[model samples]
Target: MDFQFLGGASEIGSLGLVVRDQGRTLLFDYGMTPTDPPSYPQPAPPTIDVAVLSHAHLDHSGMTPILSRLPKARLVATPVTLAVANLLTRDALKIARLEGYLAPFTTNDISSYGSRATAVDRHGTFRHRGIEIEFTPAGHIPGASMTLYRGAKDILFTGDLQTIPTHLVGGAESVECDVLVMESTYAGKEHPDRKETERRFRDKVAETIARGGKVIVPAFAVGRAQEVLMALASSGFETYLDGMARAVNSIYLSAPEYLRDSKRFRHALDGVHVIEHPSERKKALREGEVIVTTGGMLDGGPVLYYVGELYRDANSSILLTGYQVDGSNGRQLLDEGTMTIDDTTIRPMCEIGKFDFSAHAGHSDLVRFAESTRAETVVLMHGDRRELLRDALSGFADVILPANGPSFTIE
Candidate 1:
């Protein structure tokens, strides 16, 4: 089999992988990085036979809409992934227009995707013209999956993975394969204990609220926002939620089978207030003790509005719930204590903090997961520090660190 990456072989975003065997071509996880101007993977080959999506995160499903235009390409994902990806891709288009950047696909393309796509269950097998792929749960978010392609050789492709269970999802389980293609996003890093982290996060929120200040939580709408909401559930904090996560919540609620505990999930959301419209944002600001909003990196969305209004209050706090990509407004705030708003930079007087709520496996966890897969050959992708993982895995399997745009044969 011949393997190649269109992008994201050496970085954390703009991921695309192509595999050719027996004259059939397959693509996995076409994505784009939502940066300042945004970055995309190289255009997919028009001859692709099948494309599989692992999840709804922008960096994994961002570029899937364009695949609708390919004559021979058919897309596959779980029902929940398809629904959430539809919402996210449309929102991405809106953001591109608002930011004045040209979008690669149109609403027509997104609208056309359903006709060319098939919704598979998390435990289902997809077969198209002799190409077979099996889906397994990937713990990053609800409906996230890892695919094992049955071809000239059995190849397992992990999109983004979390080995430990979080409040929303269970831990990812390994499947046996001859070749393993894994993500290494946290290759050189280790996360803090999740329970301890949650305790500190709740404590900080309580402290902020006790001081008569609102807690502004900047979270990613897909997974992070829901996780934070569940963590704060049953705390009687009078929390309010804003942004596209409200839509995602509806989808998740409808597809309760995808969540770890559907009943518990429903109960957790019951106490939180949902802002139904933009006009309600001011109300959320005025009445909420804890405001959970999106654009986790503070690059855009309702989060910027809350931060703008509360930055002057020394008693208020902004708690970040995910990785702040470099060059993002959140990263600027963490590094320089200043953030850009409408091209003007200002310092925030509010308390700032970050929590280790990452949805990817850490260094030791990655090693252990890879070891469990028992693959003779391992290919690491989707991380800047892939070499660290390569070194750790070299003794167990032949490790290959492929670069974007290069094809290598695996035998």
Candidate 2:
């Protein structure tokens, strides 16, 4: 089998991989880095038999819509993944337009996706033209999956895995394979205890509220926002949700099977206020005790609006709940004590805080999960510090640290 990475082999964004075996060609994921102008993977090969999406995250499923143009390629993912991916891809197009960047795929391409897509359940198998692939939960978010391709050699591709369970989903399940392709996003890092972290987060919220100030939590719409909401469910704060996360919540609610606890999930949303339109922003600003909005990195979205109104208020706070990529506004705030909104840099007088609500498995967790796979060859991808994991796994397996645009063969 011949394997190659088009991108995201040495870094955490814009991930793609191609595998060719026994006259069949497969693409694992094709994604783009959602930065200022955005960065994309190499153009896909002219022909492909199947394209498997492990999750709906933009770094994994952003470019799958373009695959609809390929006459013979069939896109496969869990039903929840397909629905969420559709929502995200459309949102990406709108963002591209607002930012004055030409989107790679047309709206028509996204609409045609349903024709080319095959919705496989998390525990189901997909087979076409002698090609076989199986799905298992990845635990980063609800409906996220790790794919197993049963070819000449059983190869398992883990797309953004988390070994520890969160309020939204269970931990990733292990499967034995000959070759294991795993993500190393936290290759040299370990998260703080989840329960402890949540306690601190809620305590901070209460402190801000007790001080007669509103808390603005900027979170990623897909997984981070929902996780934060679940954490705040019992607090009885006047929480108001905003941005694309509202739409994402609806999709997750429709697919109850994808969530860890459907009843609890619904109960969590019941007590909170939903900002249905931009016209309600002022009402939320005046009434809400905690506002959880989208654009997790503080790069773009309704978060800017809330920050603009509350930045000068020393009593208010902006709490970030996701990874801040380099050059993002959130990183600037943490590093320089300032952020830019609409081309104007502003130093916020509001209190600033960050919590570890990350969904990726850390260094020790990665090593344990890799060992449990029992694979002879371990290929690590999707992190800047993958060497840390490579060294850790050296004695247990033939650890291969690959770079983008390179091909390696293993039999």
Candidate 3:
């Protein structure tokens, strides 16, 4: 058996890894990179026999629609992942529409992808030809899973996952294998206390509101948005959700039990407002409204319209509530202090703050996880820190970090 890291070795997204024995191949997590070298191509004949997914984050799962066009392919994911993946692909298409980027996969592609997928929700052994596969729950996203592939040689594929469990989900059981293809999203860092972060997040939202400013928060449309909404409600503020947020919340409802506070999920918007389109943003801007919008980076959403409307005002606040990946407008604004929205250099006059409510596990958690499992080799991916994983790990020298496009022999 041999393996290749098509992506997700040096970077945190576009996580693709391939494992092969003879002519048969198994790819794990077909993700798309936000920063485009315009890489990734349509697979040739024989193609990828089966692709396994861990979660629905775009960085980890976006390229599937493109790859699904290949022949004799089957996607294996959980029911919850299938539901969320469908939502993500559809949303990706919408985001692409505004950015002038073509979606690699069409609705039809997603449909076919969904059809070929065999949703499994169990802890058992499954066989494909002579290869043995097993999936365990990965506590990153609801229904997220890690797969173990056993053939002549044994290996595990860790999709983007959290080693330490959070309120929304829990981590996977680290199984023993020759190669552990794992994620290191928060490899070098430590996540802040959930209570502390939520308190601060709430306080910031309230402070901006109390100052009579529209607290513009840009969040992803999935888990983070719901998390922020719950935090706002706990903080006792009226949250005004805009863009695809309200739409996405319905999909979130598809897995209410997956949430830390299921009842709270439904009522987070009680005092809050929901803006479906750009026109409704005026009222939120003219008057001080705690507005939550999609396109988390102020890219291709009503947030940009609101920023254009109120960024000049120092009194306004922009609370960034998630990871701002590089090159994204959110990261540019959060890091550079200046941005060109609509070809205008809008120096960030508004107060900008970031709250790291990351769903991924941090440095200590990863160490704890590795130690608790007592796994011999821990493969790392989905992180920018190469040296961190190497230096921080204590007990293992076989922690493989495969560079993208590099292949490895397993048998």
Which ten-residue region of model 3 has the weakest summed lDDT? 36-45
Model 3 RMSD vs true structure: 2.7
Clashing pairs in 1: none
Misplaced by over 4 Å in model 2 are: none
For candidate 3, write residues 171-249 as lDDT tens digits: 5666666666667777678888888887887777677777777788888776677667777775555567777767657
Off by more than 4 A, model 1:
none
Predicted structure 1, TM vs. truth: 0.99
Model 3 alpha-carbon miss at residue 124, Å? 6.6
lDDT of 1 by residue, 292-332 (tens): 99899999998989998999999999999999888999999
Per-candidate TM-score against the hidden true structure = 0.99, 0.99, 0.89
- Candidate 3, residue 284: lDDT: 68
RMSD of each: 0.8, 0.7, 2.7
Q: How many steric clashes does model 3 contain?
A: 3
In the range 1-411, model 2's lDDT, one tens digit per residue, is 999998999998889999999999999988888898988999899899999999999999899889988888899999889998999999999999999999999899999976789999999999999999999999999899999999999999999999999999999989999999999999999999999999999999999999989999999999999999999998899999999988889989999998999898999999889998899999999999999998898888899999999999898899999999899999999999999988899999999999999999999999999999999999999999999999999998999989899799998
